[model samples]
Structure formats: structure tokens, C-alpha cells
Target: MLITKGYFYNRESHVNCQALKDAWVTLLSRYHWDWFCTFTFRGEILHPEKASKTFDTLLCKINRALFGR
Candidate 1:
């Protein structure tokens, strides 16, 4: 399924980073969706490398764990 948070993330002020991160982890753990995607618009990233590790690397890890490839 195609899940997106672009609308909700239109502005950084509208987001709670920790809560959003927790939600993503919780939902992903609770559901076995075939595939997914996430995004955010231009904004000041507090920690770019850490954000990548949390999102990009985590997604890749999930995909690998599920698909075994």
C-alpha cells in the first residue's frame, strides 16, 4: 500500500518527530504490508545522518527482513 505523510508534514511545525517516528515503527511492526513509501518536504533537518539512519536504513532493513534478499 502507498502510505504518505506529505500532507501532514507540509510544515515542520506541524510535526512531532519523536511521535511520528514511534508511530512509523509501531505501524510497521503491527502490519505486514507488501511495500511502502514515506516522504517529507524541504525543511531544516536537525541531524541529517541520524535521520537517514532512522528512516532510510530502517526501511531497507525492514524490506530485507521481510523479503530475505
Candidate 2:
């Protein structure tokens, strides 16, 4: 929801590794915003090199959810 809401992708916003971690921390602490980190994020939006193993797992899950395989 964050990306669609225009939060994480803004060039004005610092969405680097450390900044992302901190934002997740804040969202976890706040509770309501957890969906931004967990659900709203799309690994396919990241470059291939930047997609981690975890993202691979998520991508597989997304594929399964969409394709029913």
C-alpha cells in the first residue's frame, strides 16, 4: 500500500537498506502499518540483482497464489 500511496518509491524518500529496516521497525512498533512492509511490497519491482533469496520465496508464493500451481 505504501508504494501505491507514494511512500517508499519517492526519490525524496530514503528507501535504502538501513532506511527500509528502520521504517519496518517503526511500522512494526506502530502495528497498523505492517501491511506496507509485508503485503504492499512487490519483489518484482526490484532489480534482479537486488532481489534476495527471501524475495525468491515471496515471488514463488505470489506466483502460486495467482496461478494456483
Candidate 3:
């Protein structure tokens, strides 16, 4: 999937598999955060996690992992 702070992503986690296979989407921009960076795709946020994430939050977690908290 993708990570970003864009406020337009509203897909499911499992859908990424198909979304990738279909080539209907691709990582776009990156909302730079203190820790991680957000990845945007097709003007949408690509969090798609089971937890309550709004693309922005997912980006935070990604930051924590990649850049550390």
C-alpha cells in the first residue's frame, strides 16, 4: 500500500493487492513528517490498515518505523 497525509484515501487494506495488480494506482507525493513521510497515490491516501487510520496517521506510523519516533 501507500502512506500519506492526503485527505482523500478511503479504500480497504486487502484491496491494495488488486489495486496494485490492476495498475490502477501508484505512489505519488510524500507529506514530510518529523518521523516518517506520507505517500500519496492517484490523489488519494493509501493507508488501508485494519486499525483506525486516516492515511495521515498511517504516515505517522510509517515515520516511526522508517525514521523512528
lDDT of 2 by residue, 1-69 (tens): 146432456556535556677877987796554344543345457655556766778889989999998
Clashes of each: 0, 0, 3
Give lDDT: candidate 1, residue 34: 92
Error of 1 at 1 (Å): 34
RMSD of each: 12.4, 11.7, 14.4
Against the unseen true structure, what C-alpha lDDT does each candidate score? 0.68, 0.63, 0.53
Model 2: residues with Cα > 4 Å off, grouped in runs: 1-51
Off by over 4 Å in 1: 1-46
Model 3 lDDT tens row, 17-51: 45554453334233433655454457655556723
What TM-score does each of the candidates earn?
Answer: 0.30, 0.27, 0.25
Write the candidate numbers in order of decreasing lDDT: 1, 2, 3
What does the lDDT read for residue 66 in candidate 1?
98
lDDT of 3 at 67: 89
Give lDDT tens digits, candidate 1, residues 3-52. 25632354334555667778989987987889677766357664777677
Where is model 3 more than 4 Å wrong at Cα? 1-53
Better of 1 and 3 by TM-score: 1
lDDT winner between candidates 1 and 2: 1
Error of 2 at 16 (Å): 19
